[model samples]
Target: PARFEEGDTLVSWLAEIVGFSPSDTRLAREVPFMQDTSTGRPAGKIDLVVARVADTGLQWYGLEIQAVYFSGRGMQSEYEALQNDVDPYPPFPGAVRRPDWRSSSAKRLMPQLQIKVPTLRRWGSKLAVAVDGPFFESMGGPSSNPSRDLNDGDIIWMVPVLLPKERGGFLLSRGHWEVLTLEESSRKLLAAETVSRNAFEQTLLEKLKPLVRPTE
Candidate 1:
């Protein structure tokens, strides 16, 4: 068995576990090499991309996997904000507001990612960051920093996969993010996906209990 560093493999594995095809499950390295239109230049390494459906062309729903854990301190607060509202960030500098999800990522570093399906588009582009440890220490989000405005476009949604539950289920202060146990929410997903080490996944499923923090 191999030790995996990122979720790109896991998700791809999941897709395959559930029957996604070779044509559909493209590894980031396999996607056509295009200079990022946003930068008008090539970035060193891109992560993952998947065709929207059975026959969509190169335009894909991109996927980037991160192995960061949100520390317990402010997890619930962050989770609450995401699960509460679906508005854009307030207009720039002095609007003192949040922009809606679409436009937020539309005009910046990531720009609008062309999702494969128009309907699933509402769920916004799927950016899954699977983690094995704590991500931040405080409950206040990046937006709370007065000097900075955290734009929604940077990334609108998060799919957190808890890899290390024994450390503490995304430990957080009482008022921050809400952590959903992976064992409970993802039982079907785990069962459906053939993770190489079934026994270990089962063990962790019981021990760690991963969570999803759905934003509002």
Candidate 2:
């Protein structure tokens, strides 16, 4: 599936976990947030905006998805490069650089936890982040290294888990939403480590082997 489709799947799963009916949930992708004055282009775009009907009325949340894969180099190195690429300005004058959306690390997940979450809250919306298992594990188990003070009602972490299936295969399912305390997040950050691509793929396959059935 394409990246957007994977992200949508995660968001839909999150909506159900949050107790919103299908009819009550609305997801908008690549929603524009800011416009650049100089280039007349959008300065910022959000991956997904989730709107749901609540008893009080309509509520909205921002969902950011990150699929941290192991490149040949390193995940952290790739992240840093992406961060540098998305920078709107250049380090030196006459650098002749344009903002490249493809290179941005989706605003870097950790930084978003600190900066974007507060901004979203001030706008009357909450922030939720969805990450694949590899990415979740890489970040120290989803609760690691939180820079901001978090509350149960504040930011949420949506992670996928492998569940045993009745049919003898495993199903990748969404786990319970985790609202990280500062302490939990801190510990995770300390434990975070980068894994190689081959190792990551091997581990993933091993975890899913029980779910893969032989061809008839």
Candidate 3:
């Protein structure tokens, strides 16, 4: 997995899922929340914000995209610590290491559900997460119980598949987009368990192998 250099790639992919035309979508990058007096800056900037029409009506959503690959000091240092066999949990006082892709994705997502999603809902918008299929699969493969509550509102998950490209490259396209309410996602998350890096790697390889050219 590689880091998406351009945010538009993700935005376009999401737009395809939501059926947002060029005129309907607006890219609000680095949207400021509120100013932090201590830091003298905005609290934080959202990665992306998309405004479009839902079945109910026109709505805005905070779109968060998470990738397996990362770069630079923060992730690099964490990776190094993990390689050194540092315990992720405290009480043993081991160094903080990077988490597995599934855990990392969860770490990034939980807060959005707990904080950002609710806040955005209050502001008359919603939160939608676009994650790779592997990560989604790691999150317990969606909830099966149909009687679950939908009180907290719907949480849309746009999962794109990796398609075999005719050329040497691979394309992430043509996959399932699921809409899970907050309760449903929470249930799925609760049932989810951490999978090993090797397992995930193997699964991804199998899925992407069709795109690879046969060696002569």
lDDT of 1 by residue, 118-151 (tens): 2224534333222222222211122332221112
Which candidate do you rate higher for TM-score, 2 or 3? Answer: 3
- The deviation in Å at residue 113 for candidate 1 is 11
Model 2, 1-216: lDDT tens per residue? 144353356777767656677888988888877679999898776778888767898877777776553224333544455567756543343223343222223334454456566667678666677665655565455444343333454566777666777866556666645766433443443454579999999999888755578789
Candidate 2 displacement at residue 110 in angstroms: 2.0
Residue 118, candidate 2: Cα error in Å is 1.5
Each prediction's whole-model lDDT (CA):
0.35, 0.60, 0.63
Error of 3 at 56 (Å): 14
User: In terms of TM-score, how similar is model 1 to the real structure?
Assistant: 0.28
Candidate 1: global Cα-lDDT?
A: 0.35
Give the lDDT of residue 85 in candidate 3.
71
Structural similarity to truth (TM-score) of each candidate: 0.28, 0.55, 0.60
- Candidate 3 C-alpha lDDT tens digits along 42-124: 88667777777657777566777766643223555555656777554423323454436545555656655766666666776
- Put the candidates in TM-score order, highest first: 3, 2, 1
Q: In model 2, what are the clashing residue pairs, if there are any?
A: 143-185, 144-185, 145-185, 170-211
- Least well predicted 10-residue stretch by lDDT in candidate 2: 94-103
lDDT-based ranking = 3, 2, 1
